[model samples]
Target: MKRRDAYLKLTRHNGRAGTHGTYNPKHNDRSFNLANSEHIDPERAKGNIYWDCFYGFRSALAPQDPDDLAATFSEVERQFYESRYSNFVESQNERNAKIRHTERNRSIPDLLSSRKTCPEETIYQLGTLDEHASGEVLLAVVTEFIEEFKARFGDHVHVLDWALHLDESTPHIHERHVFDCENKHGEVAPQQEKALEALGFELPDPGKPLSRRNNRKITFDTACRKMLFEIAKRHGLELEEEAEYGNREYLEKQDFILAKQKEQLAAQQNKLDELTLKVNDMETLIDEVSAAAYDKAVEVVTDVVRTETRKEDMRMIEDTKKWVLSPERKAPQSTREYTAKHLDSVLGQVPQDHADHRCPLAGEAPEAGSPAERQGADQGKSTGFCSATAEPLAGRADPTKAICAAYRRKIRKLFSIIVRGDVY
Candidate 1:
């Protein structure tokens, strides 16, 4: 027998109606026959007859079985009694199927994924009992909630969709929010509290009056952006506008500093180039002077050699040779020859009557004075030669003295020429 049939039999033996004794064709339990009870004594089956009569009357009135009733009529009794369990199961199955279909078509998972990654807040207004409340008032309440949510969730909460479904008699808004659960740590509420604190507002107790709280009201349109701003402010997040301005200022300052540095570097390089050019010019001049001196030295040496080989003035030539080769000589041979030739060249350039030749010992024209004149007089008495206009012969015992004196005079003249800018 089916479980329902067995249940029906047990209820009948206990003198009770199966499903309140109402007949239903769709019911799994077998219907009881009222005529079968007539074969038994009424006195011996009074309890069965009483229950049958009651069920017979109820079936005639209602015309539906209690066990096979629809959900609305059956749920209360079926919930506790477990008599209408199959019907409940069928209803639950229908509900689950509908939910599954809706979820699949809507692509809830994909929507959730998108919301998780998006960095924006979702806002919505909650319905209250007040029907006459302004839209602004509704928005203000929602804005407060948004601020609280931001403080609690920090960067974790992202609002995806928000809509005020005001067509209903009791207007309310739907909101979709996403949390970056993997990135955020700890409880969300505490973080929200911190955010509110930063905004100079304390978390309000739900029971508190709106006027007592620091609640500012706003309309739906006004509330959207304001809610975002409040949330971002509480969490110390930067808005696109502020960040862009900051970046621009930073770049301008950096550019100014770079331009100044470049200018300074260019100036320094210019100065260095100028100094280098001056140094190069000075070095070139020094090299030219040195080479000229070397050539003049070679010329003087050649002249001395020629004079000695020709034997025109053996005594003076021999003395010159001795001076050139002497160990006691302070100057090198090259230096000595260079000085003699240089002096000869300068003397050759000067006129013969130039005062440089007046005294054999005089290196230059003697300063016009008493002491030099007396010295010249004494020298003249010893040498028996006039102090002025008297050229010493090459064969003299001390020919070098005359040459050296002439060389000194020539040097003084050359220095004077250089200082006077005549050499250029």
Candidate 2:
């Protein structure tokens, strides 16, 4: 979509930069006739479409009264100088440095070098009214651009005064703003609040190129060119490309946004990977701890069994269990006989007697001569084989039983110790 030649030029002036193009608000009043062009009749367009001016910050818009153009310039000029001087004083105190002219000798009169030269104003000439644009449309585009600039930098950087010069050779705007420099002669008055610094559109040092290939400075002229191009494109006006915009000129808006999103996605992926690794580490630690706890419990139970039974007796009991349960053994007539026989077999085999036995009701094996022992000793059937009781004891009723009504319980108590030891 090719359009017209969109041109933007900025003229910066100060006390040091020769006063030929220096801007003064009083200049408008002195040359009041020249403020408006010969095309528009001043008498007819006096208060209506003659000139539209906006002063002060963009947020707090201060419209100039049509009846008094002189008053508007006077007020803004005073405030601009005042704010600029106040800011200059603060900067000087903070840095505590003096502006010295190394090239100029002390004997030579360098009057302005010692003092501040701030409250600098820049004159802007946007694209001229092209063939496609009417006077009204061109002014509207200029107004939109002014508003955009203010919104972009208004909070931090102050726009003291602004106006559209409709009577000029082409439709253009003149805005005077102060910055982080020193005072300009005695012409500056201290306004209450001064801006911190210009946010965007920083102008390079005077005499430097607007768009330098080597230097990466984004200057005010460059910003204006971009703004003009965009506005022209939107208004469907023709745009003549500048030959020296360099690489930055070819950059597209969509490409910039996509690049930013790509960066964000990569950062997010890195964060997710970090979290996943932490979670995996935690899971591995938990599994190791659980395995350790289980192994510790098994070890504790095995230790208890070793303490209760000697190695020899344990070996005998294991052999007897395997033999008794074997299909070929034809295990005792019933569970009662089986219990008696198994207990007798295990107790008689251990050399130390009953290392695994502990019974409160039956004490010390009945002195080794009790009738219970006499019966087993005389019959040669078992050792201490009690015949009075055959009933199973309190602990293992589920796996064993007794018989012979009278001797069942006594038999049960004798074998009860043997059964208890097997559990551990």
Badly placed stretches (over 4 Å) of model 2 are: 1-21, 27-70, 87-132, 181-218, 243-424
Structural similarity to truth (TM-score) of each candidate:
0.17, 0.35
- Cα lDDT tens digits, model 1, 348-422, are 554454433323433323223232233344333423332111232233243434553554354345534422421
Please report, in order, the local distance difference test score of every candidate based on alpha carbons: 0.36, 0.43
Instruction: At residue 379, give the lDDT of candidate 1.
Output: 35
Global local distance difference test of model 2? 0.43
**Where's the lowest-lDDT run of ten residues in candidate 1?**
7-16
Q: Which candidate is the best by TM-score?
A: 2
For every model shown, the clashing-pair count is: 7, 24
Candidate 2, 412: how far from true, in Å? 99
**Displacement of the residue 77 alpha carbon in candidate 1, Å:** 69
For 302-322, candidate 2 gives per-residue lDDT tens digits of 343332323323333333344
